[model samples]
Target: MVSAELLKILVCPSCKGDLEYDVNADTLTCMGKHCPECGMPVNRDGKCADKECGKISKNFVGLRYRVEDDIPIMLIYEAEKIPLAG
Candidate 1:
């Protein structure tokens, strides 16, 4: 588990968005807009933040990052795509 101080300071590295920590799964999820083309979080420019993606689209999805040994694996490429309910 991450320390309260650390959790308070932690944010999504990709979009600089808020993250919700899951205690049982030991993961952090960013409920920000992400590119649907490549599933990478989008930046303020409306393009996929990841260099590999870089897709310019309005469609987006949510992403989840795993935590190992209390350290969040916040890499955009490694994040799992999740559906956002309308």
Candidate 2:
């Protein structure tokens, strides 16, 4: 339940990428996709969908942050790196 203003400025510390906030779910998802070298879709499971590039997506590639008590835990170490729909 972070304020819209705070959410607007928040970015992933690992990748410096955009984050999608689900208000009802109270989750923050890093909007990073694909491998820079392979150019394949990074699945919700944080793995490259391409069989050739069967690698786990980078640390910032999934739903990793959570909002608790109206505050977002933006720390990368505390981030819950779990698969979630973008």
Candidate 3:
């Protein structure tokens, strides 16, 4: 459980993208762009938009960080990858 102030200042360490906090899941997810066609996760440079989604566009992927005892584990290596594959 992170305070609103803390959550606002938190960003994805990997991509430097904004993070969305999930209260129920007690996690912080990165709001990075993805392939709008196939829904594969995209890189910060807008490359590697999944080999399937030939079209370069936008989707959403998340790097989820868990929170324990009200402390958020914001380490990039510890974050979980969540791809919105269509």
Candidate 4:
């Protein structure tokens, strides 16, 4: 579980947005809540509720979290870069 204190320190590089703790993924996430660039939800499913993705970026449309065995695969170059909503 990610501590709220740690989540308080995360930010979105693309938009200088504030990030929140994504409970389901246990990863930090930016609160674009809605993608300003694409004007869509960052998640493929278009959800803005408690359930969110923690990956730093999502430059693609159909790609999901690149986790293995419940572990996050935080690949720098492969990370998806989503346009932030903030």
Candidate 5:
């Protein structure tokens, strides 16, 4: 996983747009609406928004990463795309 610092600087590879952070999941995310940019999400309860978008990884690609610990599971390959429940 890239450091919070690096994640802050990272952008969506597909669109070169800004990525939003999911603090609870400790992950970086960029979930676009139908446009896949100018991101606008309607937050819900007890579920992760960006995480679900990442499951499909339908938008962002070519995810590069930097690890902070021996955990060594920061790669996008490790991130499975899923859908966010409203």
Candidate 6:
């Protein structure tokens, strides 16, 4: 389990967004949507939602980081991008 103090300073490496920690699961999830290609949260559907970019995806994706020994990995390369299932 991650300590509250350590969890407070953690954020997503990719989007710099807030991360939700699950103590029992020992995992941290990025709350923001991100484009798998651009590495940016440009769209609500995990694509470049920008009008100019005009990229869209049916899949919604976000990142998940694992916490080991109360320390978060916080590595973008190591982070897993999981497709959100509705």
Per-model lDDT: 0.80, 0.68, 0.68, 0.41, 0.40, 0.74
lDDT of 2 by residue, 2-86 (tens): 8999988998765667888888898887856544334345667767666876788554235468888998887765776654344
Best by TM-score: 1
Model 6, 1-86: lDDT tens digits are 98888888888887778999887889999957766544446555446644555567665568889987778998866778887765
Candidate 1 residue spans exceeding 4 A from truth: 43-59
Candidate 2 Cα RMSD after full superposition onto the native fold (Å): 7.4
lDDT of 4 by residue, 1-86 (tens): 64556445544443345555457765544445443333234455443222334333334222122334544433333434444432
Please report, as a residue range, the 10-residue window in candidate 3 with the lowest summed lDDT: 33-42
Q: Which runs in model 6 stand beyond 4 Å of their true positions?
A: 37-40, 43-58
Question: Each model's TM-score, in the order given?
Answer: 0.76, 0.59, 0.63, 0.35, 0.36, 0.70
Itemize residue pairs with steric clashes in candidate 3: none
TM-score of 6: 0.70
- lDDT tens readout by residue for model 3, 25-70: 9988875664443334567655644565556544455577899998
TM-score, model 5 to reference = 0.36
Clashes of 3: 0
RMSD of each: 2.5, 7.4, 5.9, 11.1, 10.3, 3.8
lDDT leaderboard ranking: 1, 6, 3, 2, 4, 5
Model 2 TM: 0.59
Candidate 3 error regions (>4 Å): 33-61
lDDT of 3 at 52: 55
Best by lDDT: 1
